[model samples]
Target: MPVKLAQSSFRDRTQEFQSVAERLRKSFSSGPGQNGPSSNTSRAEEQRSVVAHQSEFNRRASKIGFGIHQTSQKLSNGQENFSF
Candidate 1:
C-alpha cells in the first residue's frame, strides 16, 4: 500500500531528522577534554566519554526511529492533521 504524506510534513520530518543526526555526529566526533592531545589519564577519560557518547547516541537514535515509525503508522491510519 502506498502511504501519502503532505509535502511540507515530509520536508519538516526530514529536516528534523537531519538536524538531530548532525548534532549527534558532532557530539560523537568530539570526546572529553578536546582542547588538545590527551595524557594517560585523559586518554582513559576520553575512552569512557566515547563509550558514553556512543551509548547516548544509540539510545537517541533508537528513540527517534521508534517515534518516526509510530508517526508513520498514525499517518497511514488516515490521520491527516498530525504534527510532531
Candidate 2:
C-alpha cells in the first residue's frame, strides 16, 4: 500500500482504539475497587494494545519509502550493492 494510505489507515485505527480505551478507562475509574475489569473493558484494552503495535508498524512503513529511495540512489551512484 502507499505510505500515505497506510498512514491514514493506521491513524484511523489508532483513533478507534483510543476511543475504546478511553471508554474503558472511564468505566474502570468509575467503578468500585477489587473487581476485575469487565469483559468489554478487557476487550477494549486488548484492542487498544493492538493500536500501539499498529502505530509502530505504521512508523516503520513510513520509513520504508525513504529508505528505498536512498538505497536506489546509492546503487545508481555505485555507492551500494544491488546484488545479493
Measured by lDDT, the strongest candidate is: 1
Candidate 1 structure quality by residue, lDDT tens digits, 23-66: 99986788666636545477788899999999999999999999
Tens-digit lDDT track for model 2 on 13-52? 8888899999899877865443555766777789999999
Instruction: List residue ranges in candidate 2 displaced over 4 A.
Output: 1-37, 77-84
Work out the TM-score per prediction: 0.41, 0.40
Backbone clashes in candidate 1 total 0
How many backbone clashes can be found in candidate 2?
Answer: 0
Q: What lDDT does candidate 1 reach at residue 75?
A: 78
Q: Listing every candidate in turn, what is its Cα RMSD in Å to the true structure after a full C-alpha superposition? A: 24.7, 20.3
The positional error of residue 60 in candidate 1, measured at the CA in angstroms, is 1.2
> Model 2 compared with the native: what TM-score?
0.40
